[model samples]
Target: MDRQEKRAFVAFLAEVFASTSIVIVTENKGLTVADVTELRRRIRATGSTYKVAKNRLVSRALEGTQFDGIAPLLKGPTALSWGADPAAMAKVLVEFAKTNENLVVLGGALGSQTLDASGVKALAELPSLDELRAKLVGMLNTPATRIAGAVQAPAGQLARVFGAYSKSEAA
Candidate 1:
């Protein structure tokens, strides 16, 4: 790329780093275009993004950003995937790396915290934001349902008792 284009890319990456909550770096040593395309598709499905970039340009983008700690992990042919949800991004990378040996999970940064490959894997194991929200909603709804059932049980029993009394009185 020319100087202007490189500068523009660096600016764009810097802005992305500033906005995103998670950034995962991977070494795509021998991944084919099809593999990358598939990876991108899966990541995009989760509202994340994956991009292959020059280490030097990435380093420039890391300057003064919260992700600067990941600069050391940017050696060789590396790509970055980032998103608002930390678990979602890590899950995609870790799962893809499991299927594709060529894609190595180097490391990443969650906000200002730098994570090793193992840390990234651990993050992946955690439930995603949407999953956690769903679980929370379920938990909340369960108590309300139980409360409704408890409230109705006494009324139902009372109705049954009144019906039994009326039948006995008629007899």
Candidate 2:
């Protein structure tokens, strides 16, 4: 890569680092092209991207950034998988690793917090952003639903009483 290309790539990495909420680094040494492509596809499906960047450039981009903690793991043939949702990306990467041993999970970063391989795995087990949001909505709607049910109960009881009274009079 030329100087201009390198600079552009560094700039791009910097922007990606800033936008992403989490980044999981991996050592993809023996992964075949097809394996890497499939991994990238799965990661992209979760609204994340996987990039194999030069460690030097990656280190340079991470300078003065929140992801600086991950600099130590930037050694070797590293591929970065990052996204706005930490759990989602971690889930994808961990699942992929389970099937492909070639992709070694080095470690990662969630903002300023550094995570080891197991930490990243733990993150993968958490409920996703969408799932959490749905649960919160369900929790919020529960009270309103109970309120509606309570409001209708008295009328239902009154109608049942009137029906019984009418039957007794007819008899």
TM-score of 2: 0.95
* Poorly placed runs, candidate 2 (over 4 Å): none
How do the residues 1-171 of candidate 2 rate in per-residue lDDT, one tens digit apiece? 999999999999999998888999999999999999899888888899999999999999999999999999988899998988889899999998999999999999998999999999999999999999999999999999999999999999999999999999999
Per-model CA lDDT versus the true structure: 0.96, 0.94
Number of backbone-clashing residue pairs for each candidate, in the order shown: 0, 0
**Which segments of model 1 are wrong by more than 4 Å?**
none
Error of 1 at 99 (Å): 0.9
Top model by TM-score, which number?
A: 1
Q: What are the per-residue Cα lDDT tens digits for candidate 1 across 1-171? A: 999999999999999999998899999999999999999999998899999999999999999999999999989999999988889888998999999999999999998999999999999999999999999999999999999999999999999999999999999
Q: Candidate 1 clash total?
A: 0
Error of 2 at 57 (Å): 1.1
Provide the lowest-lDDT 10-residue window in model 2.
80-89
